[model samples]
Structure formats: structure tokens, C-alpha cells
Target: MICVGKLLGVKRRLQDMTDALSDMEAGNGNRRILAVGNEPTADLSYKMNEIVTRYEEQLSGLRAADETNRRLMTSLSHDVRTPLTTLIGYLDAAHRGVVTGKEREEYLEIARHKAHDLKDYIDVLFDWFKLNSSEFALSIERAELAELTRNNLKDWIPIFEENHLDYEIEIPERPLFAKADPDGYARILNNLVQNVIAHSRATRIKIKMKQKEKEIEICVEDNGIGIEKADLPHIFERLYKCDKGRSDQGSGLGLSIVRQMVEKMDGRITVRSEPNRVTSFTICFPVKN
Candidate 1:
């Protein structure tokens, strides 16, 4: 009789496991097999539970990704379509002779600027996609950071002057060496500076580089209507943007891309802001010996 009872217990445990697994298969992730006493099925039940937990976690991740993609589509529709429509409007007016002489020239010029803006937006979108994908690659090598930074900033001087913004660059004449992809490093600087020009309504901008023992630091500081304290922490997150008052004209991916590229090159980036006083973005890379 005792032997028969033991057989019955084993049979009961098997049935319970089957039922639990069936419930799980039928979309009930919460279903779990209860392993009571020192039964032979306890180890199997524990393993199955672990498998279910992992499956649930994977499903959650997929859901989050789906949500992010949905947000991306919404943002693309608004950011791309609005400017594109305006660009088309400007071009259409110019093409159909809606204005003539100086007015017509102005319209055409505005249309050209709009076209360039659209291209810039598209380029940033492409970079964000590439950086997030598996195919993204970096060619990191030891390079003189200070000289490379000076070369990069040369192109931006005209832009700063054009915008009537005062600028100061303080890159040391001596080479500060670090391991970085030259193109990627250039983009990082470009994006940060561009972020300042596009969003910060500041009159003065400063770019500085320094070497502190084992690390090299690059700082971009501006006196603009700065970021709010609430939005400071999330600025590096993909698709995050500050309040409309501060960031009325951006695809919201520039800083995110900067952070990703910095991390990929084994570097770090940080920001600080005091509204209407000062804002700064600093990046640090390990010094390559």
C-alpha cells in the first residue's frame, strides 16, 4: 500500500507539471508548478520555472522595443514632415512666380536653407540608426587629441562668426594622446557644438581641452538659456528633448548619438546647466600612453 501511495504521489506531481506547462503555453506566464516536499519533480519544476521567467523577461524586452519604435515613428512623422512641408511650400512659391525680384530671391534662399536643414535632419537620423545597429564599427587608434580638435573647430569659426556669437578655443599646442576613431571623435565635437548653436541662444561659447593625469578632458561651455534641472539627467537618452522653449529646433538624437559614440570609444560625457547663466558639456577619454 505504501509503495502504491508513492507511485500515486509521483503521478500527481507529473500531472501538476503538465497542467502548469499547458497554462504557461496558453499565455499565462504567472502559472508555476508547486514543488512540495522532497519529490523527484522538484528539480524539474525549478528549472521549468526559471525557463518561464526568462521567457517572460524576453517578452517584456520585445514590448519595450516595440514601444520605442512606435515613438520613433511618431517623432519622425512630426520632425521630418513639418519641415519638409514648409520646404515644399517655399519651393512651390518660388517656382510658380508667386513673387519676383528681391522677394523672389529671398524665397529661393529660404527654400535652399530649408533643404539644407532637411538634409541635416536626415543625416542625423541615419547616424542614430547606424549607431544602434549591429553593423556599427569604429576604428579606434592612438591620436593627438588637441591638434585634431583644433582642426575640427576651424570649420566652425565661420559659423560662430556668422551667427554673431563670440567664441574662444583653448586647445593646448602640445599633443594630448588618446585612443579614438578620428572621424567619430570629430563627429562628437561637431554634434556638441552644433547642439550649442542650434539650441543655446547664447552670445558666447568656449571650447577647452585639458589633460588631467590619466585622462584627457574636452569641455564645451556656453552662456545660454540653459537646460532645466529636471531635464538634465535624461538628455543623453534617445529621442529625449528639453522643453520647447529651449529646444525648438532639433531631431532630439544629437546628444544621444554623442553619448553612444563616446561610450563605444570607452569614454564618458557629462553636462551641467544653470538657466540663463551657463551650460557646459564635458567629455573625458582615457589617456593612451
Candidate 2:
């Protein structure tokens, strides 16, 4: 009878020890309860934390995007209204005979100029939207880099002359070739040149192209007012403008467009600047294999 009692006591103690271990694993040792039994896969706290984190991140992104959309709508409205008002004013003056003969012709010309500027802005905004939305399809074919550069430069001759700027074109006699969409290349150069003419108070601008190993360097150097170091990092940021506000505040969209075009081509743009010493935009792109 004593032996049987001792065996029974030992078995009871073993079962108690197992129960304590199970409670400890459940993190209920201090106030032991088995509401959530400890078999593997008992805890859901980590997954809950991850889900909460992802939800917060998505919500923040949505809010930021909404704010940007609102700002863009406002900027667009203002830009459109200003030019439209000028157009209406010019026509109203002509209709009232306030402007006649030579004056009327001049006013019409001014209105026409405004129209052109507005058209360009609208076109850019359209393209920017398309590109941002991933709807810009690049039909990549074999492109001659030097030829494209030459053609684009030729088109800008009148602009260079109008700005009283001199260009020092540096391109190799042998054409450098790349795989790109012609329209995309045009946007890149156009944006770069416009940026110089509009922003750089420099009298002389130079466009240089050089073969750097497997990559090519196309540099637009200006001797203008030059950009401040503090503004360089944000130079390519969309809608960011410096406070200097030259009489020529420009469209304020040039450099940002340049960066976009370059990235679309899988290329990169780098810049170096000082207050007035020199500023250069170097776009390095890979050549076709």
C-alpha cells in the first residue's frame, strides 16, 4: 500500500511539472491560466504588428499624394488663367479700337507669343503626366547620338542668337550611337538648353560631347549667375524654384524635365556649381553595345 501511494505521488508531481512548463511558455506563469494553450503557433502579436505598420505606411502615402495633386491643380489653374486673361485683353482692346494699325498688330503679336508659351506649357504638362503614369512608350531603335545632337543644336541656333549667347559645340566627327527614342532625346537636350538660357545669367554657353569609355558625356556649361550649393541637391526637384527670381523666372520646369528625360533613357545627370564662377550639367549615358 505504501509503494502504490509513492508511485501515485510521483506521477502526480510529473503531470504538475508539465503543466507549469506549458504555462510558462504561454507567458502566464505568474498567474497561471490555460486560456491560450501552448501547442506550436500560439502567438499572433508579431503578425499583427506587421499588418499595422503596412496600413500606416499606405495611409501616409495616400495622404501625401492627395496633397500633391491639390497643389498641382492650383498651379495649373493659375498658369492657365494668367495667359488666357492676356489673350482676352488683347482681343478686347482690338475690338474696342483701343489698339489700331501698328499698335493692333503689335498687340496681336504679343498675344500670339503668349499663346505659344501657353501651348508649350500645356504640352509639357501633358507629357509629364503621361510619363509619370507609365504611359510613355519608348520605341527604342538604333539612334545616332551625334546626328541627333547636331540636328537639335541647329534648331536652337535662332534661340542662341536671340539670347545673345555663343555656343562652343564639342562633338566627335564620328557619330556616337545609342538605343533611344528620338523624341525622348529631344526633350533631354531641349530642357538642358532652355535651363541654361533661362536660369544662367551667363553670356556664353558651351555644349560639349566626349566619349568616356563605354559611356558618353554631354555637358552644357554656362557662365551665368550659377546656382548656389544649397540649391544644387534640389535642383532637379519638380516645382522647386529659387528665391533669386530673375526677371526671367522662366517656366521653372526645365531642369526637372531634364532629369526625367535622362532617367527615362536609363542615364544620369550630374551638376557642379558656384555662385558665378561656372555651372555645368553633365549627362552621362551608356552607348549601344
Candidate 3:
């Protein structure tokens, strides 16, 4: 009689466990093994519960990732299409002779600017794609950090002047050598500077660099409409946009690309901002021995 009773208890526990597992496999992630106290199969129940918990966590993460990708596609459509449509409108007006004389010249210039804007947006999209892909390659080498930065910023001087932006640059006389990809570094600088130009309504900008212990520090500062506190934390996140009143000009990929390039070169980027006062982005790289 005791032997029969023991077998019946064992059978009941097995049946319960089998039903729980079936429920879990049928997409009921909330289903859990209910281990009967002191039962022979309690240990198996605990192990099964652990496995199900992990499975649920993985499924949740995958769902979140899929949602993010869906949002990105929506943003891509709006960002790429808006400027493209405007560019087409301007070109059509120009080609159809909708204006003449100096008016025509102004229309042509506006069309040209819009065309450049479209190209820049497309370039940012391509850069984002490349950075996220496995095949993206970097050519890292030891280079004179100060010299490379100076060469890159020189081109921006005229642009700053054209925009009537006051600027100051400070670089140490001593050679600052760092291991980095020159092209990537240049892109980083360009994106930061362009951010100030295109978004920050600032009259003065500063670029400063120096050696800090074993690291080389480069700072890009602007006395512009700085980022709000809420947006600062997310500026580097892919596709994140500030809610502040600054113009939403780019494809929202510039800062994201900047961060990826910095990390690929074994460096990091940080930003600090005081609204309408000062906004600074600092890049730190390990100095090459």
C-alpha cells in the first residue's frame, strides 16, 4: 500500500511538471513550475524555473530591440524624405524658370544649399550604417595629435568667419602623439564643430588641447544655446534628439558616429553644458609611448 501511494505521488508531480513546461513552451512566459514542498521532483522544478526565467528575459530583450529598430526606420523615413522633398521643390522651381534676374540667382543659391544639405544627410546615414556593420575597418596609427587637429580645424576657420562666429584655438607646442585613425579623428572633429555651427546659436567657439597626465585631452567649447539637462545624457545615444528649440538639421546620427569613432580608437568622449552659456565636448585619448 505504501509503495502504491509513493508511485501515485510521483506520477502526479510528473504530470504537473509536464503541464507547466507545455504552458511555457506555448508562449506563456509567466508559467512557473510549482514545486510541491518536500516532493521528490522539487529539485527539477527549481531548475526548470531557472531556465524559464532566463528564457523570458531573453525574449523581453529581443522585443525591446525590435521595437527600437522599428522606431529607427520611422525616423529615417521622416528625416530623409523631408529635406529631399524640399530639395526637389527648389530644383523644380529653378529649372522651370519660375523666377528671373537676381531673384533667379537667389533661388539657385538656395537650391544649391538644399542640395548640399541632402548630401550631408545621406552621408551621415551611410556612416551610421558602416559603423554598425561588422565589416567597418579602421586604420589606426601613431600620429601627432596636435598637428592633425590643427590641420583639420584650419578648414573650419573660414567657415566660422563666414558665419561671423568668433573663435579661439589653443594647442601645446610640445608634440602630442596618440594612437588613432587620422580620418576618424578628423570626422569626429568635423561633426562636433558642425554641430555647433548648425544647431548652437553661438557667436564664439573655442578649440583647446593639452596633455593631461598619460592622456591627451581635446576640448570643443561653445558659448551657444547649450543642451538642456534632460537631453545631455542621451545626446550620444543612436537616433536620440534633443527636445530643446535648436534646429533639427541633421539625420540625428552625427554625435552617435562621433562616439563610435572615438571608442574604436580606444578613447572616450564626454560633454558638459550650461544652457545658453557654455557647451563643451571633451575627447580623451591615451598618449602613445
Candidate 4:
């Protein structure tokens, strides 16, 4: 009688497990096998359920990635073609002497700017691909954070003056050391500044760095048209663009790349904004002992 009871109990639990699996197979990822306590098959049931749950999560992620790729390709096609078309028109007019003298010079100048725009777009795309690839490498090194940041921002001074932008840069005199990839750090700073210049119609910009506790912090602030509250959450998302009435001059990969680079270097970034008041991006990295 004891042996018969044990066999019946096992049979009932096996049936329950089978039904749970069937529900999962039918697209109910929430279904889980009811693990029998102290039964011979309990371990197997638990492991199998864990495997099914992981599979469901991975499948969902893959579907989301696919959707993102589809949108990326769509945006890429439109962006590349629009600039290329204008560039070709300019070049063709210049070549055929459609206009001469000042008109020709103007056409060539416009063509040059368009060419540069196309190149910038292509560069961003390449960076995105390399960043997402498995074999990408970083040359990490120990460096003074303040010095590196100063070197990076020095080049932007002339640019700011040319754009009639009032800028203030404050870096602590004391050296804050960090182990990071110099190129990656430069890219992060450049992308953030470029985003502000391209999107924000701010008259003044400020970049300041400070060391606190065991970490170093950098802030890039602009007093331009700030981002909308609804768009803040998705700003770091890949291919996400805010509906802030700015022209689509960017490939929408800048902030995404910045976040990825920061993560790769064991850092974090955050942002806060008040519409038409201020927008600031803050990045923090652990200081090397």
C-alpha cells in the first residue's frame, strides 16, 4: 500500500508538470511548474522551470532588438539619402557651370558643409557598429582626469566663440586620477557638447569637474531650450529622438554611445533638465587610488 501511494503521488505531480509546460509552450511564459517538495523529481522540475523562464526572457529581448534594428535601418536610409541628394545637386551644378563667380563659390561652400555632414553621419554609424561588436577593444590607462578634460575642451573654445556661445569651464587644480580609455573619455565629452550645440539654442554653456569622496564628477550644463519631461526617460535609448522641435541633424546615437562607453569604463551618467531653463549631464567615475 505504501509503494502504491508513492507511485500515485508521482504520477499526479508529473501530470501537473506536463500541463504547466503545455501552457508555457502555448505562449504563457508566466506559467511555472509546481515544484514538488521532497519528491524525487523536485530538482528536475525546478531546473526545467528555470530554463524555460530564461528562454522566455531571452526571446523577448531578441524580439525587442529586432524592432530596434528595423527602425535604425529606416532612419539611416532617410538620413543618408537626404544629405547625399543635396550634396550631389550642389556638385552637379558646380561641375556644369550652372552658376559662376559668387554663386559658384556659394554652391561649393554649401556642398562642402553637406559633405562634412555626410561624413559625420557615417562616422557615428561606424562607431555604433564597433561599439556593439564583440571584438571592440579599449586602451585603458591611468591619467589625470582634469588634464585630459582640459585638453579635450581647449579645442572647443574656438568653436564656441565662432558660434557666439558664452562658455565657462571650471576644472579643479588638484589632479583627479582615473583609469580609463582616453579615446573613450574624449568621445563621451565631445558627444555631449555636440548634442548641446546641435539641439539646444542656449546662449551659454558651462563644463565643470569636481572630485568628491572616491569618485570624480563632471557636469556639462547648457542654459538653452531644455528637454521635455516626457522625453527625458528615453533620451539614452538607442535611436530615440525627442520631439523638441529641433531639426533632425543627428543620427540619434550620440547619447546611447556615451552611456555605453561610460558603462564600459565602470562609470555612470545621469541628466536633469528644466524646459527653457537648464539642462545638465553629469558623469561620475571612480578615482584611481
Candidate 5:
């Protein structure tokens, strides 16, 4: 009679395991085999539970990736279509002689500007895609950061002057060596400065570099309508944008790209802003011997 009872218990546990596994296979991940206290199937149950947990985690990651892809598609549709439509409209008007003389010239000029804006947006989109691609790589080498920065800023001086913005640059004459991808580093600086020119409603901009005991710091400060305190923390998140009233010109990927590049190069970037007072973006790289 005791031997018969043991056989029945084993049979019952096996049936339960079979049912639970069937439920799990039918998309019920919550189904679990309960075996306790040295039961014949306890070891098998534990192993099965571990496998389910890992599978659940993988599914969760896939779901999240799908959601992100959906959001990206939606954003692309709206952002690209709106500007592209306007660009086509302007070009259509100019081509069909809808306006003539100085008005026509103005229309053409506006169309030209819109075309350039579309190109800029497309360029940013490409950069974002490239940066996120698995094949994307940086050629990091020990380079003189000061000279690279100075050379990059030289091109921006004319742009600052054209926008009627006063600028100050203070990169030390001495060479500061760091492990960096020169092109990637240049893009980081360009994005920050471009962000200021587009969004910051300030008249003065400053760029400075400092050498610390173990790190090199590059700072870009602007006396502008700074970011809202609430928005500061999310500035580096992908596709995040501040209040639309700030400016609608950006693709919202610039800072995200900057953060990725900085991290890839084994550096860090930070920002501080006080609304209506000042805004600053700082990048730090470990000093390379």
C-alpha cells in the first residue's frame, strides 16, 4: 500500500508538469510547475522555471525594440513629410511663375532656404542612423585636442558673425593630448554649437578648454534663454525635444548623437542651464599620456 501511494504521487506530479508545460507552450508564460521539498520533479521544475524566465526577458527586450521602431517610423513620417511638402510647394510656385519680379526673387530665395533646411534635416537623420548602426566605428587615436578644436571653431566664426552673435574662444595654446576620434570629436562640438545657434536666444557664446590633473574639459557656454529645469535631465535621450516654443528647427537627435559618440570614445558630457540666464555644455576626456 505504501509503494502504491508513492507511485500515485509521482504520476500526479508528472501530470501537473505536463499540463503546465502545455500551458506555457500555448503562450501562458505565467504557468509554472510547483514542486516542493525533495519531490521527484523539483530539480526539473527549477530548471524549467529558469528557462522560462530567460525566455520572458528576451521577449520583453524584443517588444521594447519593436516599440522603438514604431516610434521612429512615426516620427520620420511626420518630421520629413511636413518640411518636404512645404519645400515642394515653394518650388512649385517658383516654377509655375506664380509670383514675378522682386516677389518672385523672394519666393525663389525662400525656396532655396527651404531646400537647404530639408538637406540639413536629412543629413542629421543619416548621421543618427549611421551612429546607431552596428558597423559604425570610430578611429580613436591620441591627438592634440586643442589644435583640433581651434581648427573646428575657425569654420564657425563666420557663421557666428553672420548671425550677428558675439563669440569668444579660449583654447590653450599648449597641446592637450587625449584618446579621441578627431572626426567624432568635431561632430560633438558642432552639434552643441549648432544647438545654441538654433535654440538659444542669446547674443553671446563662449567656448573654452581646460586641462585638469587627469582629465581635459571642453566647455561651450551661452548667455541664452536656457533650458527649463524640468527638461535638463532628458536632453540626451533619443528623439526628446524641449517645449516646441523653444525652437522647431532641430531634429532632436543632435544631443543624443553627441552623447553616444562621447561614450563610445570613453568620455563624458554634461550640461547645466538656468532658464533665461545661461546654458553650458561640457565634455570631459581622460588625459592621455
Candidate 6:
């Protein structure tokens, strides 16, 4: 019942409505008009404000999480370092003859051993921070595997003897060359052997290496109280402890560091266990022929 002129006006209004919606969708809102030259808009402004509010909230949450991590790292650094400094100082004093006799010798031995354990723990903590903060780079090169293993074994022989651990190091007569970082490979072996000595509580532990055409598999096996299935998956996680109460003799960082070091070498580490029967950590790394 509208006149032709009124119909044309209604059509124009429909066009304006379509244009406004299109402009909003395309984020070209300078063209949208709520009130012409004297423009004053409420609805559109409210929508934009709401979007900004949500974005700000999300950013705030991220910042808060970052701050919490910083605080945790700072506190951990302070707490762990203090006791370590004191332990090292006392051990040095005892070794330097500030104390003497069998009693002093025993105290010094305990101090030295515990200081080494504390050092291992701090190294793990710093490595954890690095692992989380940086991306891993595989800097591989050709190196003799047997020589590397021999040197590491020699370095740890004293510790093994001191702890009364019977270590059986099995290596091939001829050296096998592998592509990997010498330091990284050494750390992998050290962590595994250290775990065997510290947590395995086994009188005898073995390091067995298998060299194949494409990869090398090494395992540190022990006769010890094995890990539960539930604890296996979590053991590799950062700062996770499996023994409901931490093992009295260990820093709890050994296995975690082992996992990280294996991955850094482009290797895989897996554990197999039977409670009080045997526990073995197997690692495989690509070998350079």
C-alpha cells in the first residue's frame, strides 16, 4: 500500500543497512554511520570495547603465568645453591686438614660424596631451565664410541669402587664410530651409570652396548627394586618423583636428566622393570658408518 516514491526510500534504507553490516565485517568501520556528520554511536562502540577487554584479559593471564615461573626458578636457585655452597666449603676445609684422624676422614668422605650429589642436582636444575627455554640443535660428528665409553668409565670407576658397586663394562674390541656430540654422548652415559649407582641399590650393574649397521643400542641394567607401571610414564616428566617419598640416597634428577640428554642426541630411552628383579634403561642412537 506504499506509494512508488516511498518504496524507493525503503530500498535505499535497505542498501544502507547492508553496507553498514559489510563494513563491520570487513573492519572498515570508518564508513559505517550511526548518525551522519554529527555521528555518535553506542552499539558498535560497545562491541569493539568488549573485544578489547577480552584480549586484554588473555594477555594478562599469560603475563601472570610467566611471572610465576620466574619466581619459582628464582626461589629454587637460591634454596639449592645455599646448601651446596656450605657443603662444598666444609668438604674443602676437612680435606685441607682443618680436621684430622679417622673421624675427620669419615666426615670428609661423607661431605665429599654428598657435595658431588648436590652438584649433580644443581646441574640437572640448570639443564632443565635450558631445556625448557631453548630449542635443541643436533650437532653431530664422527667419533670413536669405544674410546668415549672407556674414558667415561675410567672417570666413574673411583665412585663405583667407593660405593662398593661391582661394575662390568662391556665394550667391543674394535671401536665403532658414531655421529654425535662427544659431550652429549658422555652425559647420556654418565646419567645412566649415575642412576644405576645411586638409585638401583644393586651390588652389580652392567653397561651393555650393541652396534648395528644403522643404530647403536646401549643399556644400563641392574638388579634393583623396579619402578611401578604408573610411575614409569611420569618419571620422564620435569621434576617428577616416583618413590612416594624421595629415595634417601639420590637427588631424584638422574633419570629426568637422562631422558633429556637422550633426546638431545636424537636417541630414544626406554625403561623395563620387574619389581626387585631387574631394571634396565635402553637407549638407541643413529650410528655413523
Alpha-carbon local distance difference test for all models: 0.91, 0.75, 0.89, 0.90, 0.88, 0.71
Question: lDDT per residue, candidate 5, 47-133, as tens digits?
Answer: 988998899889888998788678878888888898889878877887899977888888888888778777767877888999979
How many clashing residue pairs, candidate 1?
0
> Candidate 6, residues 67-86: lDDT per residue as tens digits?
75776576567657776777
Over 2-36, each residue of candidate 4 has an lDDT whose tens digit, in order, gives: 69888998889899999988898899988888865
Q: Give RMSD to native, each candidate.
A: 2.3, 9.5, 2.8, 2.2, 2.8, 9.5
Name the top lDDT candidate. 1
Worst 10 residues of 5 by lDDT: 243-252
After TM-score superposition, the amount by which residue 203's alpha carbon in candidate 1 deviates from its true location, in angstroms, is 1.8
Instruction: Summarize candidate 1's per-residue lDDT along 19-108 as a digit string, tens digits.
Output: 999999999988888996588788998998999999999999899889878888998999899989998888888889998889989998
TM-score of each: 0.91, 0.78, 0.87, 0.91, 0.86, 0.67
The lowest-lDDT stretch of 10 consecutive residues in candidate 6 is: 32-41
Where is the poorest 10-residue window by lDDT in model 1? 243-252
True lDDT of residue 120, candidate 3: 76
- Count of steric clashes across candidates, in order: 0, 2, 0, 0, 0, 0
lDDT of 3: 0.89
How well is each residue in 1-289 modelled by candidate 2, as lDDT tens digits?
5587667855665565467556555654242222233422224333433554565577678888787677767778888888889898998898899989999999988888888778877876776687678566776667788879998999998889987998889889998877677888888888778777767777888999887777878998988888777878888876667765222344455677778778878888999987777888999888885
Q: Which of the predicted structures, 1 or 4, would earn the higher lDDT when compared with the native?
A: 1
Q: Mark the 10 consecutive residues where model 4 has the least summed lDDT.
A: 240-249
